[model samples]
Target: MTTLHTPRLTLRPITPDDLPRVLTYRNDPEVARYQAWALPATLDSVAGLVSDQPLGAPGWVQRAVTLRDGTVLGDVALNTQGPQAEVGVTLARSAQGHGYAHEALHALITHAFTDLGLHRVHASIDPRNTPVAVLLTRLGFRHEGTSLQSYRHRSEWTDDALYAVLAAEWTA
Candidate 1:
């Protein structure tokens, strides 16, 4: 498993023990509502998702965000394609707005671009998710464009904003 440490957080692989905490954020109505998959998250479902994939695959990295105190905050991952990787993050509702996501994302990006030798990382966010969009911008991600009706949310189609940051563009 791959593990990374930041000033205030640690990013590590998701384990079976993390299912309960993962479900906390996954089950949140607000969180799930904006996500492409809106079905209620169950332990079995989460297990299935993680079990089907390997951590730190050749082109991908999936990790659980945790605090120095050992609190599991959420998840952060990089799904890779060639030299670019797609970033995804989910923070526990209670941990939101505390900069934990930012800390974890920075660490993950550094690992992907520096340690893993990746060239670029990007994220697809629902336009309605203003906080995430703002967060990505703060992290040096440029808004590339929007995809119309690109994702299915609660049985309806929704638009997504594409945001990207290049290795040379990252200041952190």
Candidate 2:
């Protein structure tokens, strides 16, 4: 299992014990607003999602983002495909505006490029999520493009923005 540490946070593989906390934040309307997860996430469903995939397996892996004192803030998710990967992060409502997401994502991206030797990492986010767009920009990801009304989300056609960073472009 990969465990990464930032100055104030730790990114570790998600475990069974984190299901409830993950469920709680995942079900939060605000937190789920731009996320792709089904609504009303249950503990059993969360467990099934987190436990089915082993950490070093060939698909998605989730990491728990916690404070140094062991408080669960949220999670960072990476879906790897050969030398490239897609990434996402979620923070509890109370954890927003605290820079924890930035810190956690930095650690994850650095690990992806430096330790995992990924060629590229990217994210596709709802265009409406300005905060995430800014966060990605701050992390040195370039805005590749936006797909207009490419998919139906929450009963409406929504635009998706793609942002990416290459291993050679990553600074840390």
Candidate 3:
């Protein structure tokens, strides 16, 4: 039961009701362009995709990104069990360019570095996602490396850019 509040958004666990909201953007080709998952995410499959969170567990937890009034804006995921937690974010088209994603992710990453005592926090994003790459750079995450043809999306091989921030370097 983790709920993090930023100035304009709240990050909490996913519920069945959130599937439709998530599916809307998740199914959008423009939004899912550089993401790994396939398009047209079905309700049944998405409903069961909700994570119970279960912190300290060995996998990822998808959290709902919402407004104070509970309007779903997008979602974020954190792979909580590793030495360096990995994070990913998806925001509705309407919510983009508003800093909501940065706000939500900053809170979660702050927790990962401080409360969770993780040594580092990282993300592997498609190189084509320039916006996210810029966002990560602006957040002080170092561009660690790039792996070519490391990820398969649809039927094509894509390059991945690895960005990370060390706990010792996390000023926030």
Candidate 4:
């Protein structure tokens, strides 16, 4: 399992004990609003998802983002596609606006590109999520384009903006 340490957070493989906190953040309408799917997440569903993660897949990694104090605050993942990977993140409401997402994501991206030998890492965000767009841009992700109605959330189609950063663009 891959583990990444940031100044205020640790990103490590998801475990059974993290189910409750994961559901707490995922079930929130505010947080689910921007996600690709908006299912009412249950413990069983979370367990299934975590169990299904492709642990041995080359260049694929998923980690639970926790505080140094051991509070599971969210999740960060790198889904591989040839030389590129898709980056995904979800943070608890309480952890928002404190730079934890950026910090954790930065660390994850570094590991993906540098250690995992990926050439590019990308993220897709709901166009309405201005904060994430700004964050990605600040992290050197260039706006790649948009996918119309690419995400199905709550039985509705939503547009997603694709942003990406090349390995050469990463600084930290």
State residue 34's C-alpha deviation in candidate 2, in Å: 0.3
Q: How would you order the candidates by lDDT, starting with the best?
A: 2, 3, 4, 1
**Cand. 3 TM to true fold:** 0.94
User: On a 0 to 100 scale, what is the lDDT of residue 29 in model 3?
Assistant: 84
Name the candidate that leads on lDDT. 2
Q: Candidate 3: where are CA atoms >4 Å away?
A: 54-56
> Model 1 over residues 18-81: C-alpha lDDT tens digits?
8988888899987676765447877887774353353335554568888988789888877878
lDDT of 3 by residue, 55-158 (tens): 43457787899999999999888886577788899988999999988898898888787777888889999978999999999888999999999867888888
Query: At residue 25, what lDDT does model 1 achieve?
Result: 88
The lDDT for every candidate, in the order shown, is 0.81, 0.88, 0.84, 0.82
Q: What is the per-residue lDDT of model 4 for residues 14-74, given as tens digits with 9 covering 90 to 100?
A: 8888888898899998887787644788887677446445432555466889999999988
Q: Which residue pairs clash within candidate 4?
A: none
State the RMSD for candidate 1.
2.2
Provide the TM-score for each candidate, comma-separated: 0.90, 0.94, 0.94, 0.90
In model 3, which residue pairs have backbone atoms overlapping below 3 Å?
none
**Once superposed on the true structure, which residue ranges of model 4 sit more than 4 Å away at CA?**
49-60
Candidates 1 and 4 compared by lDDT, better number: 4
Worst 10-residue stretch by lDDT in candidate 1? Answer: 48-57
All candidates in order of TM-score, best leading: 2, 3, 1, 4
